[model samples]
Target: MPERAPHGTSPSHPSPEAYAALESLLRASPRGRWFLAEYARRNRTAETEMLLEAIARIERAVLKPAPRQAVPSNV
Candidate 1:
């Protein structure tokens, strides 16, 4: 039978060396560069949209427009 991993740790997670090797391989290829760019763009767009939505909600809830004051009547 295969041995189990220690408590709080899993075999599915890659070690640091394995992760570094994979990162170097990805950084070395043109297609990988394109993939990384697209991933970053998508992540940035999602974050921007969420921020905009939060700002909108805050404006609606806390930033009410003030009432205009009436102009003084001419003598």
Candidate 2:
């Protein structure tokens, strides 16, 4: 694996939720996918995989939240 850019010095090592957001953006954009692929190629490392997994976990967590309904107002 390639060496990381030191702790806290790299890309802020965003949270799982942040990663999921990135994944969403990538999926929503054709150019984003290309960007991700190119980025991975240039900065291949264990951290990258971890980031991707974090993204997946975040997606699951966000989607698993319970739904709430608004109460009806009395006329």
Candidate 3:
């Protein structure tokens, strides 16, 4: 028989760092990003939707725009 994990630990649950790294890698790949987006859409929740909204907002703010400054009227 296979050995079991300790009381609070499970093989199915990886460390936070591992999950972060995996998420980073997935976000970096087109296919993986699609998979994540589809999974999140299929399993939507209030919190999940909020998180996705926040992520989209941040991505738009950071990745899709160039900062602009107001020009002086006299210039």
Candidate 4:
């Protein structure tokens, strides 16, 4: 991974978080399949696999709700 620039800015390359978010969005949104396929084809063999994994992760995240935190009573 590239070192972070001062003030949390990426000097040239984007972060992995950004790539994951984009892959998730591209997989879910309409007309995104074309983008994913084309991107996958342009990249190496593992790119498509990674895209699939990202989609699966996004689906799971959307389907699963976060756990609720219990609050102590003041009474």
Top candidate by lDDT: 1
Which of 1 and 4 is the better model by lDDT?
A: 1
TM per prediction: 0.59, 0.38, 0.44, 0.37
- Candidate 4 lDDT by residue in tens digits, 14-45: 59999898889988966897888876777866
Q: Candidate 2: what lDDT?
A: 0.85
Q: TM-score order of candidates, best first?
A: 1, 3, 2, 4
lDDT of 4: 0.84
Write model 2 residue lDDT over 1-75, tens digit each, in one string. 965786768545789999999799897888998898888887787778889999999999998968887878973
Ranking by lDDT: 1, 3, 2, 4
RMSD of each: 7.5, 15.7, 13.1, 14.9
lDDT of each: 0.91, 0.85, 0.90, 0.84
Instruction: Please give the lDDT score at residue 58 for candidate 2.
Output: 96
lDDT minimum window of 10 residues, candidate 2: 3-12
User: What residue pairs are clashing in model 1?
Assistant: none
Error of 3 at 28 (Å): 0.8
The predicted structure with the larger lDDT, 1 or 3, is: 1
The TM-score that candidate 3 achieves is: 0.44
Candidates 2 and 4, the one with greater TM-score: 2
Predicted structure 4, TM vs. truth: 0.37
